[model samples]
Structure formats: C-alpha cells, structure tokens
Target: MPNSDNPSFQTEKASERLQRHADEISVRLTERGAVPNFPEPDDRTLRSFSLGEVAEILGVSGSYLRQLSIDGLGTTPETGTAGRRSYTLRQINELRAYLARTRRKEALKFCPRRREGEKLQIISVGGSASTTTSLYLAQGLALQGYRVLAIDLDPDGSLSKMFGYDYPGICFPDRYVSMYGALRYDDDRSSMSSVIRRTHFHGLDLVPGNCELEIFERESTKRFHSEDLRIADASIKMVSALKEVEANYDVVVIRCGGGIFLTAGAYGAATGVLRTVRPEWPEIMSMRISLSFLSHFVSLMEEAGMSVNHHFTKYLVTRHNPRDFSQQEAVAFLRKSLGHGLLTATVWESDAIRDAEVKKRSLYELVAGAVGRSAYEQAMETLNSTNAEVMDIIYEVWGRPPMYVMRASRIAGKASS
Candidate 1:
C-alpha cells in the first residue's frame, strides 16, 4: 500500500472523495434544508439562456455575439427582437466547445438548426446581364443578418468573380468544383455540397458557377427529348441540389445564365423569381412576352394537376431616371399593367454603382474620396431603402413578419459610417 500523499494513493482516493462529497451533500441538505453545490446535469441540460445572458457568461460584447450568429456559429433566435433571442443550454455548450476548438486552431463546422416555414428564395432577372443585380440583392440580404447562398448558374461566372472567386482560375483540378457536377447524370448526389464555398461577406456563401456548366447544359439537351421533361428534369436537379444544403441557408439566390433552356430550369426551381425590367419599350415588350410565357406554363401545369413548385413573379423597375418623363412613364405603365405584381421600389441607374462594379467591390465597401463617392453615397442610400422594402415584401409573401428590419437599419448605419 502506498502512502496517502503518493499519486497511487490519490488515484485510489478519487472514488472516496466522490463518496465524501455525497455524504457532505446529504448532511448539508438535511441540516440546512437546501440543495448542495453538486452538479445538476439534468437541469443544466434543460436550461435556456437569453442572448445577453450568454454574452455575459461568455464575457463577449453584443456586437461579437451578433457576429458569431452572422458567421453561422450561434443558433438563430426567436423572431420579434434581437433582445428576445434565447440560447439553449445545449447550444451554449456547443458554442463553448466551438470557442475551445477555435483557440486550438482546429477546423470548425457549422450546422444550422432550421425552423419550420423558412423560405428559400431563388432569384432570377430579365435581359442579358442580371448578375450585378443578383449580387447586390445578396449583399443586402446578408447585411440584414440572414444566411444567404448566392448560386451563379451562369457559365460566365460573373457572380462568382464579384464575390472574389476569379473566373476559370478558382476551379480546382482535383474535384468537380462547380454546379456542373451536381447536374451530371452520375449517381453521386453529394457533389452539390462540394460546390458550397464561403465568401468574404459574413452570412453569405456561394455555389461558384463557371463556363464548365455549359458542357452539362449541352449534354442535358442531347439526353432529354421532350421539352417539358427536359425543363422539369433540370429544375428537379437544381432544386434538389439547393435542398441538399437548404437547412444551412435562409435564402438561395440564383443568378441565371445561358439560353432559354437554362432560364426554364431557373423558373422551375424558383420559389420566387425577381425580374428586372429596364424603363424602355422594347425591353418592356420583351418582359411582357416573358410574363405571358410564364403564366401560360403555370396555367397548363395547374390544369394538368401536375405536382410542381410554382413561384410568385415579382418585377423590379431598374435603370430608372425619375426626372426623365419616358422612364417615369415606363414605370407608371408597368404599375398599371402589373398592378400588385410590380415591386414598389425602383433601382436608379447611377455611375456610383458602375464605378463600384469596375472596382469589383460592393457599394457597402466603397470608401469616401473614391471616384464618384457622392454618387455612390446617393446610390447606397437608395439601395438600402430598396433592400428593406424588398425584404418586407418577401417576408410578407412567406407569411412571416420581417425579423431583421432593425438589424438592417444597424447595418445601413454601419455602412454609411
């Protein structure tokens, strides 16, 4: 037998120490009629902590807590107000574990706990180049504290580049790194997750698209003989790919590219389709044709009782000049023709937006004294307002009150400063 002070004796005494603790707990409870200091794993596991309480416990600032949520580290809080958001004891423990792992420089994983009725918005635009509009919308959504995944369905990869993934250059040699792999006829269904990439912005992820998708698009055309089946199949694959990671995002915005076939695919996958129409007659005429086509297809599908995901088509009046009578008239004409289908906010054409695009940066990132700073500031104001308005409309469509309006205001103030 080793001495009581020896390591071997201490190891043997550990169980005795626990037994003594239990005896003490019983003595204290009987004498004082109060609970002892023993750990209550059950109570701790069932406990819920408020956001502020969690922040206090963790010794972090409110802003830091918000960023943790933005970075997909914290659980989403109940809707109403940020102050009302609560974290479960389990979530708090998970966050602590995450912090410990981070301190050790280990790779971290984020798995979002999604609530019911969370929407998946797949945005599309009218005309030749809608990537810029899509990027701005995504930026706005992320700023509003929503997890956004922007999918660049275009072969040009313009949206990918806007988010800092260079065209053709960012493609990995070892794996099929784009949406191309997911759409292929192969049985590998997990390829969509591989295409998920984090962006420079918080709360935003990207599914990088490139010219490589053209090969898949062409192959799809050759394989599917019926136009309906072809469009249906493409939509199914695209939507399925999105659903693969649907739990991780609040919205999925697809900046579509390629020909009518690809456009049809987008239409099939959309929960909501945002179409931007310039204030011009020819473009307006083209939009009318597009609307008619969409309506006809939806009507046909409904009549057939086919199981399909129908989308609400919302029109945005872009490139407007309020002072220009022609542009104003175009907007008025659209409102009268489309009634409630048209978005209330109009996106003005500004050199500031163009300058930011030239620099490959977002309006929120443009600094003062940059070329067209005044114009950019004006554009930024309008963009913030439009983003909020559009968000309200979307939330209304999804049958929920807007959760991040206040957060959006905070983000706008931060960007302005």
Candidate 2:
C-alpha cells in the first residue's frame, strides 16, 4: 500500500527534507568556511565567518566571543571528547556575518515592519529571579521606544505568564510552526526572527519557553556530549538570529533562568563548584554557596570557552530589605563591583512600588499621580546621588571624568528645581 498514515508520513517526509537541506548546508560550509564571502562583503550581500575564529580575529574578550558562537549558545557547552567544544561552520559563519554587519554599521532597509534606522541593543539577563528584574528593566527599555524582545529561557515560562502567554498560538503558530522544531525536524528556520512571537506590547516580541526545554536537559544529560550547551548558548543563537533580521529591535532582553546552582548537573559541571559546600553551620553553607555560585558561573562560562567580559553583564539585587540575610549577602557581593547598573531595591517593596505595580506600570510611568509623582521625583534625586558616587568610582579608576561634573549635576539640578 502507498503511504496512508498522515502523521507518520508527514514526520518521515519532514525528516527526509531536513536531511537533504543539511547536506546542502554542509557542502556550502566546505566552500565558504561559513563566511558569506571570501574577503569582500558588499552592500547587497551578507558575509559569514566562524564564531570562535571571529572572536580570535577581532581580539575581543571571551564573554563577547561566546556571543558570536551561537547555534543557540546552550546554557551549557555541548561537549563531545574531553575538553572539546564543537560548532557548525554554517551557524558560525552566520554569526560572523551578523557581527560584520553590525561592525560595519551598513545601512539595511529590509523589514517593512521595522522603522528606518535604529540601534538595537542585545541585553541578556541571567541569574535566579532574572524575570522580575528583566520585566522591570524592560519597562525602561520599552519607554525608550526601542523595539524589545523579552526572551524567557527558563523552562518555567514565568516571563511568558508575566504578560500572559498563549500556548496554542505559539505551539500551532499559523501553521503549527515551531521555528526551532522545524529547524530540528525540517531545517526551515535559520534565524531567531523566524520564531519571533509577538507580545502584548506594541514594541515587544517574544520567543517564549516551553516544557520541552526539560527534554533538552534530559537528552543532553543522557547523550553527555552536549554538556556545555548551557541555556546561554540560546542567547548567542537568538542574538545572531536577531542580527540577521536586520537589527529590527533596539534591544533584545533575555531572562536567564535560576542560578547555575540549580542546573549544574545538567551542564556536566564539577558539581562541587556548582553546588554549595557544607560548612559547620547551615547558614555558612548558604553564605558560601551564594558566593561560590557567582564566581562559579563566570568560571563555568570560561570553561565552556566563553570569556568573561564585564561589559556583557550587569548584576541587580531585588527585594531591598535590610533584614534579609540572603539578600544582604548578595548585595554586599554585588556592591564590590559597582557601576555595572545595579538596582539594589525593588520599587514594589516600597509603597511606591505596590502602587506602581498595581497600575501595571513603572515608577517612572507614575510621574503624574500624586504618590507616583512624588516617588519618581524622589527617585530622580536618588538616581542623581547614585550617579555622583559612580562618577567618583570612574574618576578613581580612570582619573578622567572631572569630579566637579558629578557633584555639579546634582547641585545644579537641586538649585534649578
């Protein structure tokens, strides 16, 4: 009998089609080394290069280099032989073209949905409880009129629900499209925009999370080769993808899931570095564990062949309660490395925050209401104070930014107001 089963037949057909495409891509890689062009990239065309090689070529820090090497920078590295990391030349070349495009600042006017020209910032959030921080920060990004894609890399999908996510809409997008699924199953989706999902906001798009992320962990653990494919790898993939979409958004905000302390095993980590060591006291373990996690995360990324670049990350501490030990410990650890954009307090923790959240808004959004207005006025004052201190740090570190300007901005603003 000829093929009669629709589901089975479709799956087989899809598999076959993907295999053929893979062969074609493989051949192309052989010819081009994944770069779009040999040495000359033109206005009408895009050139590609390998991710790691590009990092070497540019001499950027390691953390920034990892951004280039994404098929989807798995939160961990995809390990095969001991100490070996792998990447496809096609994906690598795609990333190379992306960086090249951005570096050249070439004028691209492709996507009709996109406005004429805007600078897109790729902001990825990583750490436990990054959702709240990302959302709060996203309000600021949205206010700036930059198109934003808030990606929920966690399996829990908290960010998706924060603004209300749709399962059927994404799962069965128009024609049951899983941009990632199609790539894995049929090799149709090459870039991140191919899977871009719209959110409630006009300027925001989402590539929401799914329970299948659990399977990615499970399969990786079993196969053991993809150990370094941490979720951040996905950040690299999406960044490269967005770059291909012609820099559609001004900022791409990624919400990293919980601490590596939770997913260390999945990443095939030493387990000791990823886990908290037990001291004489339970509190001691917790204390040391938090510190260890901070250092360990950077170390793990380095181990996976990604360099640590300070410009690539900013640490934010939330809740802001003076009494909480964990929060206190975290803040102390964070304060040592100041000037990297730390929001030491959550606005909701204060009355100003509750009122602001209830309004489905930001503290800045409430500048008109009496309480909202008062809070923001105070916030600006505080911001000015903080900026002065940061400026001092900069002056101390660099001996440049005249200290007078820092003190003067606050004093001048106060007198004018």
Candidate 3:
C-alpha cells in the first residue's frame, strides 16, 4: 500500500505485522497444514534470521526494511557479503532509534493544546503574485485538526481572498491585517479565541485581508527612519504578537505577498523573519512556478538578497501537472543541481482547488461536490502519515506550515523512475 511517492507511507507497514506475529504462525500452520520456518530465538545465538529475523529483533518486518532500502537508508544486501540477507544487532538498534525519532515528528503535525488563559495564535502568509510552498503544509496541518488562524500578509490579499473575503480594491485593509491594527481595535479579544473567523470547515479559521494592507510596508519603512531598509524588526514585532496569540491557539500560519522574501528593492517581511531565525528552526519555502524558472528565480532572489542556505532551505514544486512527467524530471534535475534544497509532495495541479478558492470554499468543504476530488485524493496519497517516513522528519523540523497558499496552479507528475 505504501508508494515511494508518498514519503510517510514509506515502511511502518509492518506495525501490524509485529502484533500479528504470535497468531500468524498458528494461522499459517492451520491454513497450510505445516509447521512454519519462522526463526524463533532470543538475542544470544540469533546471529542470522533472514529479513524476518531482523524484523523480529526490531519488531518490524522485511517489508519495512524494504521500504528503507528503497529510500537508500540502513543495511542492505549490499551491506553484507555475497549478497546474502544480513542485519546486525547494532544496525537493528540504530534503525529502531531512527524510526522513533521520525515518529515524534509526525505527532506535532497538529497544534499544541493551550493553557486555560492562553489565546490561540493564528498567523498566515501567502500572496497572489508569488506563491510560497508553506501553504500546502498549512492546509495539510489544518486538515490534521489544528486550530489555525492564518493572516493574509500579502498585499494582493489572496489568503483572505481564498476565504471569499473581497479585497477592498480601492483602499488597503491595513488595520485588518496588521499587528498594530489588531492590537488597536482588538478589545475583549477574549483569550484570543475569537481571533479566528471560521471558514466552512471546523478547525480552520482566518482573519481576512484587504488591499489597504499595502500601506504597512511603506509605513514600516517610514517608521524605521531609514531609506534603504529591511523589515527584520517588524517581523520580530509580528512574532511577539503571535507569541501572545499562541497562548490561545496552538500555532499560526502567516501568508506572505510574494515568494519567500516579501518584496524587492528595500525592506521585505520575509527578510525580517529569516533574519531572526535560530539555527534550530527550519522553514519550508514552496514555490509555484515553471522548473525552467527555478534557476532564474534563485538568481533573482540572490540578487535581491534572498539566497538560500542549503543546510536549512527547501524548495517545493507547486501548480504542477501530475500527468506531465517532464515536471518530475525537472524537479529531480533541480535537486541534483542544487544539491540539498529540493523537497516534494505528490499534489497535482487541479482546477477544482482554484474553483473552490474562487467560491470561497475549502477542498474538504467543496471536494464532495467538486471536480478535482480524485486528483486531490491522489495528492493526499503522495504525502506521508504522521506515524512514519520523511513527512514526519519535515513536520518535526518545520513545526508549523508556512503562511500562504497558492491558488489555481497546475501540477505535473514525475516521470518514470
């Protein structure tokens, strides 16, 4: 049932096998009318047990190891001599530890529960111009049952737009989407719980945006009292507000206007967030564009001071065509070329997502009556579960999804392996 395309589905397939062990032997004997050849020995003299033996020691299975093998992790036939199946006790222990570590990550895919007096923190970042990859993760986490309040930090107001809130075309909604505005008029905000404006869905909520928000960037620049500017301090201020909100909600997803960095020329909000990041936290930047545009975008971002640090950066391919094998090939090529910054999910480009956004509805809300449900389901299959695989690793490192979501993008499939 696990496919390499779905990172979380990788292995952990044998969790059931470990439970079935005792009864399985009896069932096998009764069904086949023969005693099984399954190895049964304690730690001592259990030098060799085939793949099953290793699984027994690890309380896993050959299928599980086979998944790891597919990922090019842990012991393999090549790890032993003469291509004989082999697994060492030490390796088994190491693999178990690794699995445990990955499991912890999957657990945090949801929001952390709050204290009695805590207000839920809702942060969102996304835009209509340049899309960030974090939106996918945010949407996924929201689906996982987190109380998320997304802030539409983008001037185009796509995040608010996604919820069907019309962006005031004439005046910017500065007060509606800014930290200063929220604080000014947010009387009786009440445990920060009311901060979230619910969508058609149950767990997800948002504070809509208007075109007026464009002023903050300019206002922030002026307040800083500098010409050539950066938004690092503004970012810290926003984070502090989020920290207060966090007391109410478990997490916040912030949607930005364009790309990973806020804008070009001078001070950008993303620059501020990145400027304050600790070496420990990891952020996922999702880009929705042509593979042909990747290097160009990287170069442009670098010129704009948005260069990625390979150690903590990640690239996501969005609005892709799952049927377009070329896109998959392009991603692999980029990964090889970039060396360490490419990450992917099985989501395909579907018009339903766009249509749903246009209708101010979410996929879960519209999927039943929507057109792209099948493709969306396939896309869901592409991501791993919280219990196992690389998804867990990413969720653990990243903590929360990025703030924005891209709309009306097409997805292309990966080519043959």
Best by lDDT: 1
Query: Which sections of candidate 2 miss by over 4 Å?
Result: 1-121, 166-190, 199-202, 225-242, 259-312, 321-348, 355-417
What overall lDDT goes with each candidate model? 0.66, 0.43, 0.42
Decide which is better by TM-score, 1 or 3.
1
Stretches of model 3 off by over 4 angstroms after superposition: 1-136, 170-196, 224-230, 259-312, 322-325, 382-395, 398-417
TM-score of each: 0.66, 0.47, 0.48
Name the best candidate (by TM-score): 1
Model 1 bad stretches (over 4 Å): 1-114, 169-174, 188-190, 226-229, 293-306, 402-417
lDDT of 3 by residue, 1-417 (tens): 545685545454666545456466656665785642211111222133356545533434568777887787754433566544655434544454566566665332222333354434332222222222334445544443455566655656566555555445634121133332542213522222333455543345665545445555556556546654333444434444555556444445565554222232112212211111111112112233323343454455455455433213333444556556666566566557555444434334556556655655444343333556565555434332210222333333445443111110111122111
lDDT per residue as tens, model 2, 1-417: 645665656557766866676767657775786632111211221122233433432334456656533444422333455534433323433444455456654212111122333234445554443565566555444432345666665666666555555342222212222223312212444345555666544466776665544544454444345555553443233334556754666555656555232233222211111111111234344544655776675566567665444322333443355566765665565566444445432322346655655544444433435365565555434433333332233233333334423443645475458
Cα displacement (Å) at residue 80, model 2: 64
The candidate 1 region of ten consecutive residues with least summed lDDT is: 37-46
Arrange candidates, best lDDT first. Answer: 1, 2, 3
